[model samples]
Target: MNNPAPGASAPPPAPAARRTIDIVNASLKRRYAREARFRFMGAAAVFLGLLFVGVLFGDIVAKGYTAFAQTYIQVPVYFDSATLDPDGSRDPQVLANADYLGLVKASLRTLFPQVTGRAQQRALYALISAGAPQQLQTMVRQYPSVLGTTRDVWLIAGADVDMLVKGQIDRELPEADRRIKDSTLTLVDQLKTEGRIEQRFNTGFFTNGTSREPELAGIAGALAGTFYTLALTLLLSFPIGVGAALYLQEFAPKNRWTDLIEVNINNLAAVPSIVFGLLGLAVFINVFGVPRSTPLVGALVLALMTLPTIIIASRAALQSVPPSIREAALGVGASPLQTQFHHVLPLALPGIMTGAIIGMARALGESAPLLMIGMIAFIVDIPQGITDSATVLPVQIYLWADSPERGFVERTSAAILVLLGFMVVMNLAAVLLRRRFERRW
Candidate 1:
């Protein structure tokens, strides 16, 4: 080492440590700057996602909110006993089969006797929905005394008139470009001026079934199918998924078979949902001969699709039960099965149920798989059992969306709102169930 100068302060040591700290300080500022940028980007991404979701919700609500009500025209019907029962016999079948539509037409003509030409009369008749006949029949059958009297009854208007009343059709557009011609528009306005045409809450929209005519179409069949499919799916998937999870997590010996199953379960969760539809097509529909387009087949397919999620969620819930709980149960002289079932299962039940419900919700929204099983068929009758022909809400929406009618457009949006509402309800249920039964330890 070099000798220090006599009596002089040692030459100032090279400022290495200080220089090193300066370097670090410079890089630290850059690092912090980068981190801030990253946070800003993350927040921006989240904000963009939420913005898009809000826009979508707003659009759906705006289009669908109007479908809850429909336009109707009050017609003075003279239900002549001669037209209903020519022989003067009060036969229910004869009354039921009478030309109720004819009565409605006669009433409209009486109201506008100047509408003489066939074309003008046809336009007048077109103002009323075909469902008016059914409505009249129902009314007459319920009250036999009305068969010979004149009564003003409100009847659902045709799709065109309903749209016009709802202001969905553009008035500024040329009459040639519009479905409602000038003559029809004049008739509609006259009726409106007379205080006979109006809008009311559409009961048939909820109570009726699918129809080629938009005004007569309803979601009752779809709702019933959804209920039946989900019920059967829950029944089949919950017990099977939970039981398998318990067996694998608590009792099964560690081996290659279990490892294979573990990998397969993971793989199945990622499998395209459409594959399950095809599997359902091959196995349930072809091999087992389950009725095509029935809720039974749909339930089987959805159960298969949901099994992986339930199994994974259940296993995770079971593992969450602390090992100490198992040791304590065993220490108290509990058998292995008893330790798992009596002690662990009760604590994990909420998670298992939540997982099952979420899986069912996913199954509820699925349409591709159902389409493969022929659930895309136009099912008009409400399903009463799992074996009955059915169409769920998603499929109903799909069918309606594909229709080339103005009325169906609103109905489609309304159906989507209903579906989103259901999914929200289900997810909320999961949260509530967890909060209700969660054991933090």
Candidate 2:
């Protein structure tokens, strides 16, 4: 390495070190500007996402919060034995079959004696829900001694009357254009003046089942269906998904077969969810004869849909456990199974749980899958078990949204709010669980 010729003059002596602040190369400046732009764009995207979420939540809450209250009219329901139960025997079946409707009509007529004409009377009768009689029947059945007494009962008003009482219906609208007639609206106002019209917290919305009457419709059955479906989904998916993941990651030999399986699982995660509904219909319902419209079938379908997600997440978690941990455990006389079960698996649990919760949140909002298996049917009874006919909360929302009743609009929104609330709770719970189990090392 002969030194450069003296004429090279030492290549103009090496430039003195410059302060970083002074070294503002154009390329470096451009790169930094690009990074700043990227950060600004990312922040803007996040803000936009948060803004949309807030707006959506605000709209839902505003539309639905009113549904939690129901209007009622306090009317005297005289339990005339002749009108209600001609039979002296107090048989439950006979009592149920009694003319409770007549009693309600009589009570209403007694209050509005001025309402004459058949058409006017019919309109007046429309102010009270047909379900009111059923309410009275339940009341009397609960209090058998009230069979012979005249008692004041707070009865749910009809959809139109309920809307009017809640000020949702415009009384100034033309009688032809309004659901509640002017005469009926006047009577409702009269009842309001009498201190009998009241709005109460809708306990029945949480207690009773669905009904044909919008005023009587409740989400109890749908809530029960969701509970059973989710419980079954979690029970079946967690173990099966985790087991498959473990076998693939920890036990199975690396081969084309395993690779094919992994590919299929990843594909399944992106398949249209409704396709799974169709598969459930063809396989579980048609081929296997599983009862359609039951939570059991819904659970089975959801479990299948959730399996790929859980398996992928669990495998990733298991793989993330440092190989050093496996090597150290094996070097210390620990069996492979012990290494996984006692060490790696425990550390991976938080990730598995996080995935499971996200999967469940997806399942909870799924309606199309449940709809394919006959869960779209209008069910009035709360499901007693997984096999009982039922609809989930999302399906219920769909049903209510399709209903023609003005009241159902609010109900649909309310159900959506409830579903959203449940999702928020599940996400929060997942965060808590992850934090609780997180192992830094």
lDDT of 1: 0.90
Clashes counted in candidate 2 amount to 0
lDDT of 2 by residue, 254-341 (tens): 9999999999999999888888999999999999999999999999999999999999999999989999989989999999999999
Off by over 4 Å in 1: 1-21
RMSD after CA superposition, every candidate? 5.2, 5.6
**What local distance difference test score does each model get?**
0.90, 0.88
How well is each residue in 176-291 modelled by candidate 1, as lDDT tens digits? 89998999899999999999998899777788778889899999999999999998999999999999999999999989999999999989988999999999999998999999
Best by lDDT: 1
For model 2, the run of ten residues with the poorest summed lDDT: 17-26
User: Number of clashes in every candidate structure?
Assistant: 0, 0
